[model samples]
Target: MTLKHQPAYIIKMRAKPGQGDRLFELATVGMEKSGASDRFVIAREDEDPDVLWNVEVFRSEEAKDAYENSPLADELRDEIIGLLAEPPMRIPVHPYSALPAAPS
Candidate 1:
């Protein structure tokens, strides 16, 4: 079996009142349709009444890229952008590790 890589992204948005719920719903649905696994709501911080933060981790960067290019992604992006009070903040992460076992 091929091992999947780790990909994590932190998305920060300043959303208008009542917009977070819709954005969350749209994102979750789109991610699932694009082959994402182990999805969960990581955290929601109330920086203020009009600002919010979300951190989500995916199984691999390939999965995340596929989701980004989906038709649902386009729709979600448009809708979410319209509701955002500021540009969304996005950061990509790649982690590395060394296996304990080595070939002789």
Candidate 2:
């Protein structure tokens, strides 16, 4: 279950003025529906209410590319773009380590 060499990214997005919540909601829904990654997390920026970050680790680059280029993603992308103040930014990274989730 290691994401050691997986295609991972930290995507930064800023919502238009007061749309952060809506943006987060929609993005969460998209991620859940796509099931394109091994792990994905959405978090709000503590110092900036309008900013949100999406951290995702896909099983492989092909899976990542396929999901990103799919029609479902395209539609969600357009809607997401409309809620953004500006273009989203992505920072790629390599996961060298990971810990399994604890039991509920």
Candidate 3:
């Protein structure tokens, strides 16, 4: 089996008032435009209407780096940041094992 990057990233943030949907949209768009993720999941917090969460599994560190350098990031920089109540939190993890071994 071909080995792949196992970088798991978790992002949690609070959207600006009435901007939850916009934030979520931007999140998905960013992922779609980057083409760097193996899996991407988005969700809202149970108790906080403004809270947003994203789980992204990137194919590799190189993939993630490419995403950071992507033009999409610059394109949405203002809009996404404006929709956020504060800076988003990003957590990166290195996994020991995973199914599929590679993202489809």
- Identify the leading candidate in terms of TM-score: 2
Encode model 3's per-residue lDDT on 16-48: one tens digit a residue.
899998888888888888888877778889898
Q: Could you estimate the TM-score for every candidate?
A: 0.67, 0.92, 0.81
TM-score of 2: 0.92
Residue 60, model 3, lDDT: 81
Model 3 misplaced regions, further than 4 Å: 1-5, 96-104
Clash number by candidate, in order: 0, 0, 0
The residue-by-residue lDDT of candidate 1 on 7-86, one tens digit each, is 76667777778877666666667556656543434345655644555555566677767777778778878988998878
Ranked by TM-score, top first: 2, 3, 1
lDDT value for model 3:
0.80
Cα RMSD (angstroms) for every candidate in the order listed: 6.8, 1.3, 3.3
- Global fold similarity of model 1 (TM-score): 0.67
Off by over 4 Å in 1: 1-4, 47-49, 95-104
- What residue pairs are clashing in model 1? none
RMSD of model 2, in Å?
1.3
* lDDT of model 1 at position 21: 69
Off by over 4 Å in 2: none
Q: What is the C-alpha lDDT of each candidate?
A: 0.64, 0.89, 0.80
Q: Which of the two candidates, 2 or 3, achieves a greater lDDT against the reference?
A: 2
Tens digits of per-residue lDDT, candidate 2, 13-101, equal 99999899889988899888887888988999899988989999988888889999999899999999999999999999978887888
